[model samples]
Target: MLIILTMVLFALALSTIVMFISSLLSKKTIIDREKSSPFECGFDPKGSARLPFSLRFFLIAIIFLIFDVEITLLLPLVVVTKLTFIKTWVITGTFFLLILLAGLYHEWNQGALDWSS
Candidate 1:
């Protein structure tokens, strides 16, 4: 009990000290008109704020996100393959593959995977 209390107090003190040092070492910068101006692709300001963007950019981003999430879901299975539920894991993996292939086929049919004009 006493040891835990001491540890908590020590952690609090350490964090406070680190924060104080960081604050002292940091430089404060004032925001001016140029700094506050809207930035786009590192270029000068363009037309109105309601300017339209290419839908191809959005489609590519969404496809990348879908594949990214699929890879994330596959990582855990790779790590825990030695467990007792190997057959269950295999079935789950096959299901995931089927879903991924179906999505790929759909994208191909919709011309979403084509980069050439």
Candidate 2:
């Protein structure tokens, strides 16, 4: 226990020293304004650097990801069914599938599935 404590302390001290030295070395002596601006072939930029994002498309993507992961989880149940009794397997599968369906229904009811507003 003492040896482990000593090793951990040594590591902590070494990391702290390294971090301090790195911070001191990385300090910027001078800051330039033109260098930070977005460049456009030696000309001034016309528009903002950030682009507009579609929230509806993002919602659809998130829904697809959730359903995709849930479907993958269902794949393991195929092997589980072969190892378990018919009644238990049926009940377990039905419950899991129902959960997935219910989630889908909820999303649909909330109009999140609709692409056109």
Candidate 3:
């Protein structure tokens, strides 16, 4: 136990020393405007680089991600069914499905599922 503790402490101290040395050597003293600005053909930019993103598309994507994760969670239950009793598994699965349905209903009622504005 003493040897393990000593080795862990040694590793921690070594990592700290290496990180300190690397940080000290990596300091940047030069700051130039050309390096910071987006590259153009020796001319100022015409417009902002970032374009506006669609809020509806973002909402749809979030909904897709949430449902995708729920499906993954549900998939594992099929494998576990053989190991457990059928009644318990069915109850658990049904409860989870009810929660997912409730969330879907809430999103629909709130008009988040509607694409047409």
Candidate 4:
């Protein structure tokens, strides 16, 4: 208990010292101007902030998120397979492949994957 307490205190002290030193060494520069505007595209700002975004952008974003999450789920399966001898990895891989293929087919059929449209 004493060792853990000592370690925690040491870590806290170390972190605080590092943070203080970093802040002290950092330059305090805040040059606020037109360049720091929200729309830094150089083009004149137009329309309201509540402008409706493209549905195609949302659709693509959703599809990308779905695939990203699928990849995240696969990472755990992959790590577990490396640690233990399990045939479940094969099943999971096949399931993921099938689902991905189906999603691709669906997207292709719906013309959502096509950018030229």
* lDDT of each candidate versus the true structure: 0.83, 0.86, 0.86, 0.79
Provide TM-scores for the models. 0.59, 0.54, 0.54, 0.58
Q: Output candidate 3 Cα RMSD.
A: 9.8
Model 3 TM-score is: 0.54
- Screening candidate 2 with a backbone cut-off below 3 angstroms (N, C-alpha, C), the clashing residue pairs are none
Write one digit per residue (lDDT tens) for candidate 3, span 6-82.
99999999999999999898755555554676765344465665656678888998999999999999998988887
**In candidate 4, what are the lDDT values of residues 11-77, reduced to their tens digit?**
9999999999999997666645444556722333555556666678778878899989888877887
Return the top candidate by TM-score.
1
Instruction: Report how far off residue 89 is in candidate 4 (Å).
Output: 2.8
Candidate 3 ranges beyond 4 A from true positions: 1-47
Local error of candidate 4 at residue 58 (angstroms)? 1.3
Model 2 agreement with the true structure over 1-117: per-residue lDDT tens digits: 999999999999999999999989874644555567788534557565576667888899899999999999889889888787688778888999999999999999999999999
lDDT of 2: 0.86
Clashes of each: 0, 0, 0, 0
As for candidate 1, its clashing pairs are: none
lDDT, ranked from best to worst: 3, 2, 1, 4
> In model 2, how large is the Cα lDDT of residue 98?
99
**Total residue pair clashes for candidate 3:** 0
